[model samples]
Target: MAVNLDKPQRWKEDVARSVDMYNQWFLNFAPGAFRATRISATVSVEASLLATSYLRDIRPETMKKNPSILSMLRMATCPPIAVDRLIGLAGVNSSLVKAMEKDNRLPVRVTGDLLDKELQKIGEIIERMADPDIFVWLARGDEPRQEEIHRAATIVADRLCGAQANPIIRNEQEKRQLAKIKTWLEARGYNEAETKARVDFQNMEPGTFSFRLNVKVRDNTVNIPVDAVIMPITANKGDLPVLIEAKSAGDFTNTNKRRKEEATKMAQLKQSYGDNVNFVLFLCGYFDSGYLGYEAAEGIDWIWEHRIDDMAELGL
Candidate 1:
């Protein structure tokens, strides 16, 4: 990648565009996160509009993907005093709706008994907002202005990133989804039958490498192909070429018995193919599933692991 000195500015521009698009498409999604906010109860028509504008400027996808912002704030170790103060401000109940509006304060709606219960919860969140870690107001702040629900999502995403410090690997069903990736590749002129196709490249230098993948589809009269091979021809004719088994994350294991079993399988493949089987191994995985392994052969480091992430990202 070429070094770009003004990357920060460029990144901000992309984030801004993402946020704007998110607000326009999903702001009024009923029964969603937006419904659970103060703006829904008070009907601060103007405030909601301003809040939407503010939120459209910041990336809301981050928040939408993360856990609740309130939960993240509590985990951040915010002080007690800060929490209490915010709660007190939020606890205001049965305020004169018109008076509160005239004074530019949050307008409270009249809902009789249920009003007290909701106010209590809102008060607590407000108290937490008092922390000098002002962002704790979460997708809040901007007094008297109805905060856009989209802003809430971004705040939650920020809190999750800043507080969790965990990868929280998503797409747990990656093993199942990998099939789509293969199907997508085939549409792009990637023929699985051609993976086993080899072209003689004599006089190639040591440490040279080539890859092949053969996929089988179900047919009444045909066999299903479920194998891939990556060949790394060694320079020393006397030295045995190393073969690697490329399986998906869950398929690959580090047990001693499994390693020995794989070794035996490779020995059989070598014997069956002879000189043609310079390097033979099972490459069983989707493009993005990270289960590739590595080994050194004759001082040459060979990555036997099949990588799917980069290939999938490229839509190959």
Candidate 2:
């Protein structure tokens, strides 16, 4: 009952359509999403700059009193640097900077005494390395220009948010796909599971679905997260739930590169739950013949976003 997977010859046509659909969606919505996020980020960066007095007072006491500003410290510099790069430049403890960047706060173990020393080193590096042209207001001996502050914040916002814009789009796309699945399943009398943890498939009422369920695999020690779990309407006691992974890719190269991850998950499921385990993919975006062929060879199948109704073939 497989669609494009069973009919290998039709792969080229399906792939073309899938890619076109993804491109059209991106062209229509991606720019607006990016701009909205950047606008929000700009507001945040401007607030951080104003709090720091335009990077003129990055003293340990100031940073300690306002720990949240540490996240934006590098961005406020003349030329922003990433956390790892700042660590390399400042020659500070890698763990400290890594923790700061990851959690957006100073680690609790870093005492006030240590903070002074660390901030001194980091501040000196920024002062020495930051571009003189960008920080000219510091030497001008007058109030920082409002336009300059806005321009600097905008640049920082672009750096901070632009890198994550594609990922934001991908998350939004996944949410949309899941919403569609919810609507269709609900229409068919499928109830949504309320539990946040993994559910016992046998106990789940027939015709129920859950999002982001975790399944124990690989000898029941490792947990594999699936996008959706569905109990077929005709399910009986002890029947395993169907597992669906929602996948999207902007290009063929990344899909081919990450194709093995799905195969690994499939192998783990089969090993733990036996060959009867129902694991599948809900795919959108650019997956080419090469990617599809590999998945098919591994006995993995997919339901395209364009053909969501084919989920019926899986007893959804």
Task: List model 2 lDDT by residue over 28-145, tens digit each.
Answer: 9888878888888889878877766777766776666656565567765666777888888888877777666676567777767787799788877765655456656777856778
Best by lDDT: 2
Model 1 ranges with Cα > 4 A deviation: 1-119, 125-129, 133-157, 163-169, 172-180, 183-316
Candidate 1 positional error at 150, Å: 15
Candidate 1 per-residue lDDT over residues 184-276, each given as its tens digit: 345544433243545223322333322332221222232212233222222355443333333322222433224444444444444444444
The per-model lDDT (C-alpha) reads 0.32, 0.80
- Backbone collisions counted per model: 16, 0
Window of ten residues with lowest summed lDDT in model 1: 295-304
Report the error of model 2 at residue 61, Å. 5.7
